[model samples]
Target chain A: MGEPLLVQSPGVPGSPVVTVAPGWAFAAVAVLGALVVVAAMLDGALSARSAGGPAGGAARPFGEVARLMRQRRRTTVQADSLLWRIGGAGLLVAAALMVAVVPLGRWTIFDLDVGVMWFNAMDVMVWALVWLTGWGANSAYSLVGGYRFLAHGLGYELPLMFALVAPAIAAQSLNVGKVAAAQEGLWFAVWMPVAFLVYLLGVAAFSVWGPFAPALGSDVAGGVRAELSGVDRLVFEAGRYALLAAGAAFSVPMFLGGGAGPVLPDWAWVLLKTLAVLWLLVWLRRRLPAFRPDMFLEVGWLVLLPAVLVQDLLVAVLAVWRT
Target chain B: MDMSPGGIPLAEGGEDRDGLQLDVLKVRLGPVLPHWPAGLVLHCALQGDVVTEVRAEVLDAGDEGRDDADALARALDNLVSVLALAGWEGAAAQARRIRDAALETGDRPEDLEGLERLRRRVRRSWTLRWSLRGLRPLTEEEVRHHGLPPDAVGDTYDRLIRMMDRAATGTRQDDRPVFRVEHLALLVIGLDLAAARLVLASLDVHELQADHTQHEVAHG
Candidate 1:
């Protein structure tokens, strides 16, 4: 929890506020977020190539986008069309909204007083969004996927909230800008490793990627996205990747000291750092097995939750001792 | 036989987890689901996402008389399905590549080398093993009583490892053979939908005789 950006600039006094226009900042974040998702897809294709698998062209992601754009919409009778539409597009919308609060080199679209809470709130929104995607399908597998995600959300939410609390406790502010500013001396990741690790776990859980992908698992025939086709499928998948990008972007402010670096402009450092975090998350998919919801439930509540709480407690004590 | 307004047929109502009366959804797992074995259909009774009951049946009976080459192809195909289901897309693709190559050049040392590599990679995957282990464990008695293949006599994990082994070193047909589709019920009935699918994938039921028509015709 660092200084709120409402009344004062992010840095120490005497430096002029280097802020971008609202439209420019919004545009920049949108482009950067989209690019990050594309880069991740390319990395996946490249990994497949190295492993002697099917090698898609570098433009595969874009080609997919174009293909989905041209595909016809599919509908089932008695399906919750309104809910389905909302859920399909809502992922991308939520990701964009979440990224609005994240600083790309100290130029956030909205430097709200409670940026961290906003980030957390958007992630929580994914629970309903994913469930709606499943429920709207009017099919069994999708409904099961929706049910699985809720169980998964129940498991991960406590630890994630606690992890968010640790960084807030360190900065003594819930503001994202302040959290990043407070980390100028030493990154929160170095000091609060447990919280950072839990945060990453939470990111994977919400994004439904890598090991936490049971909600969209192949076992249930692509789970929540089972019935989606044409543009609906495209939007839902794009939204999932977008959420992954947003989560990767937020880790910059929350743990790795935002855009703090030498030589390069703050934005360049921000881009580089975000890509690094995104790559790590993508690579983890190949390395780890998906967590069984039952086993993960035990680990999240009994192990991870307690670990982050202790981490938070330690951070609290350290803050008190320093002041 | 009531139908939902969606024009999709619905199953009769049943008691749910809360002891409240809820309609049991009759969902079919596949004849067409991605990563699912081809021609397999599982009719399930669902109280929410939990499978209250299930009946497994294959839509089409594969033709009789599969040679060793055919067996290897079938094994590789099953390997691909299981890997895909386990979310190892890269490995699944690799398995697919190997499967394609095996089909092209049967029993060549070069092709055998690819199978060996695939076998090592699949066996070494802790994730794959972790996902499959302890799921639908079959007792030795169950294996004998049900007349499963020697390779499939173990649990899902063991069966998968054995499958990889067989894929690497060509399968040898047993003189006294016993393979039954009904045994799938024992392995699948109590497991959740995900685990059940994995168990079935490990069994690679696509290569087995599952249709009742052949038996019925023979008996008739």
Candidate 2:
């Protein structure tokens, strides 16, 4: 059956049951707690510069947005109303809350039993917020950004829905926490490699990385953020880091061994995994060329969609064959 | 390193520009008096007497609302011109060939249809919409009901070309304008008439190299 069985086969004393691991989700929560400062830097990656490269592994997080906040804000006099300011602040809040439910290292702010459904809802919400931020600014650049975000919404959203479902088939669980726990015998990345990679790619596309980063890039001259400044800009930037942390958390439990590690505490392993993934993403930004949105949309609908569907099917076969 | 907008990387064997050594810088001067004589904004770098790098960004007679697609295209055209001036030889000549051939494809017997055809091909790539976010032109309906003229769409090419020539020289690093006059202009005259003037103005722009010092259409 296609139905996901999140709580299954009560394993006791040597046999573990497929139940949602509530404690593990907090491992990701701790990481989010730590990144609250760096995301506030508006130009941290450039003039501000993040110093946490391998040589300075123990150094502080980047903070460009914070410095910008201290500067006096500027606004175009032709604004029809104060809607842009309100809209900017509102959308940032919405996106921050959306990141709350998404599990990092199996721990989210609070994981509901319907983990897959929660994540999907949050993504759709983010789509709306980005559009709002784009539209509210009233400037031409912001209008274009809002519309661009909607197009990106079209490209990555559905494929992500399919990719997240592969583990549900293997474990018969919709609870992301449960799905992570089931990775003890084998990490989903081992058996469901396509879903793992596609999901990361999808996440990257959603988050505006690699070739999919036409929005808010140097080329567009900070497309959506073209007009934003001060504290409002800081919040928007902060929300991005939170989202990144949340994505790393969700993927870790599914693709890697979740909290499974040797010698180190489970939570420490989770932190290491989160940092590793975050580092990998930053590295990709420096290494790969930016892709056009049209190119990725074609890739998403044509190639990634079909591949993830097949991977889902394979996981189904394996589930039945093993049972 | 010859560019007008996004500047050049001076570091040797830099990974950018596909590992090419040339570099250029984009500089914005300021909100202008409009009466002031057009001055040149020079993006200068030297690799000996051959003049290895220079890019120009003009403040222009006005502004091109901060758009990346617009900026990149302006940068691209500027880069080509700067390379030619710096003794790259065939660079400027090759650009003129493409622009001239494109000029023919655009001219037709009818006034309006001829203009629309040019907007589709020469102005910018509609397919480019998929490549860059937020630069897509409004549909005929969206543009019209808003009271924008049919030709106003072509004005983007005009504005970009104008920027190629003037924005580099006229705008200083701090020459920030509250808004471009053209944005307000489109609101007044409508698009088709606006588009014609812009197109006519741009026709010669591609043929000659950009020079802010000389305002005369034909320059040395």
Query: What tens-digit string does per-residue lDDT give for candidate 1 at A62-174?
Result: 77778878988777667898898898789988888888877777666666778889988899999889999999988788888888888888999999999999999999887
State the lDDT at A308 in candidate 1: 96
Give model 2's share of reference contacts: 0.05
**Quality of model 2 by C-alpha lDDT:** 0.48
Q: Pick the candidate with the highest lDDT.
A: 1
Q: After superposition, how far is residue B42 of candidate 1 from its true place, in Å?
A: 2.3
Residue-by-residue lDDT tens digits, candidate 2, B87-120: 1222333333333333434322132122233223
lDDT tens digits, residue span A1-323, model 2: 12222443243222222334444334434547564443222223421222222343322233354476686776653543355655455543544554454444433444556666776676677766666666566454455455556666677777788888988777677766677778887888888889988877666665555445545643233656777788777666566656655566567766777678889866567667866776565445433334444345776788888888999888888899999
> What interface RMSD does every candidate have?
2.6, 17.6
Off by over 4 Å in 1: A1-21, A47-56, B1-3, B9-13, B17-22, B32-35, B108-111, B114-120, B150-154, B210-220
Model 2's chain A TM-score stands at 0.78
